[model samples]
Target: MRRLFILLLLVLSCSSKDTLPDITVKDIEGREVKLSDYKGKKTVIYVWSRTCAGHTEDLKKLSRLVNEYPDYRIISYAVAMDIKDVQQSYQQIGIKPNFITLIDPSVKFNDYFPITFLPSTYLFDSKGKLIASYAGLPEHL
Candidate 1:
């Protein structure tokens, strides 16, 4: 019975890590935004830092995805960067993102979703369950 209980605990812990946590984060405008509010839509979160390479191209691709996939919610989460820097990067790229732009100066989201590397992309289903995650830009996007 003890072995079965341990196995069940392990399974539960592992499965819980795959879902988006009900945490609040800040948007570019410094407004409190709840991650849970994005539920009921196919969400794509792109995590990037200011120093990360290929961000410019990735942002451009994300812009295309925003237009191409209207059904999916594309979110650009900038970590360890100031709001001004994030805004500047967008302006420099010459593309206004039609999707959501969030700022994570302290990388609070990492606690829920482990981001081992920069420029990571995560896809979640309408139910807030993780569908797929890519270390770099996914070619399909």
Candidate 2:
């Protein structure tokens, strides 16, 4: 039974990873948005916190990517953060991000993503399958 259970766990783990879960996160306006909403559209799901300096840098790069890749449907999630508190700081720095950056205060997606090692970004194809996951900011188009 133990061997069978282990085997089952491995299979499930491998299987689940292939398809990104349909998780619900928030937008800058505090509205609930689900991952399924972006299905069939190439998505860039990023988990970030307002406090991380790395994340701050990443956001600058992300804005550039949005302008470069307007053809692709990019969704940059500002998870585990509140944009209101830092909006002035974000703007005072002259950083205007074009992509939709969501705010996830509920920590709902924490189970699937790591909060501490944030600024983690995920790329999904038009079909909503996770194609790439970058730990920091992405510089490439």
Candidate 3:
């Protein structure tokens, strides 16, 4: 029981903060990207995995949001997945959003962001502060 309490304490302390880790993912063209690249701009970080119908619908929805809100700087990034899978996910779903797609093949994001569910999204405001974070697809369009 004592060990369990300590483990729980560690886990709770690890994930206490909501701010995203300073992680950079690469685009399809192999450009090293940092989260702070677009300072003073809002960013939408989408963490999706590629598989049979895995978060495909959510991607499409986000694509629509990108299209609808062109004025807002929206960046949809694929986390915990490879470039191939990230590209394939878009191709397989036939979704062409007005946002940039990125890759994190080594599942490095999972270490920082506890993304147990697919289609997890993080909304960062103009100051690069994490404004809102959602797990799974948000019902509000």
Model 2 misplaced regions, further than 4 Å: 1-20, 86-89, 114-116
Root-mean-square deviation per candidate: 3.1, 4.3, 6.9
Which 10-residue window of candidate 3 scores lowest in summed lDDT?
14-23
Pairs in steric clash, model 1: none
Q: Model 1: which ten-residue window has the lowest total lDDT?
A: 15-24
| Candidate closest to the true structure, highest lDDT | 1
lDDT of 3 at 58: 76
Summarize candidate 3's per-residue lDDT along 1-141 as a digit string, tens digits. Answer: 999999999998865254445567798777888655755666677777665234777777776777776655666667667777677767878976667777877766676666777768777676666777788756652
Off by over 4 Å in 1: 1-16
Candidate 2 vs candidate 3: which has greater lDDT?
A: 3
Quantify how close model 1 is to the true structure by its C-alpha RMSD in Å. 3.1
The whole-model C-alpha lDDT of candidate 3 against the native structure comes to 0.69
* Candidate 2 lDDT by residue in tens digits, 32-80: 7775677766777767766666866676777777777876776666655
Clash pairs (backbone) in predicted model 2: 40-126
For model 1, how does the per-residue alpha-carbon lDDT over 1-141 read when each residue is reduced to its tens digit?
A: 999999999898887467777777788887988887888999999999979988889988887898888989999999988789898999888988877998888787898888988889999999889989898789885
lDDT of each: 0.87, 0.68, 0.69
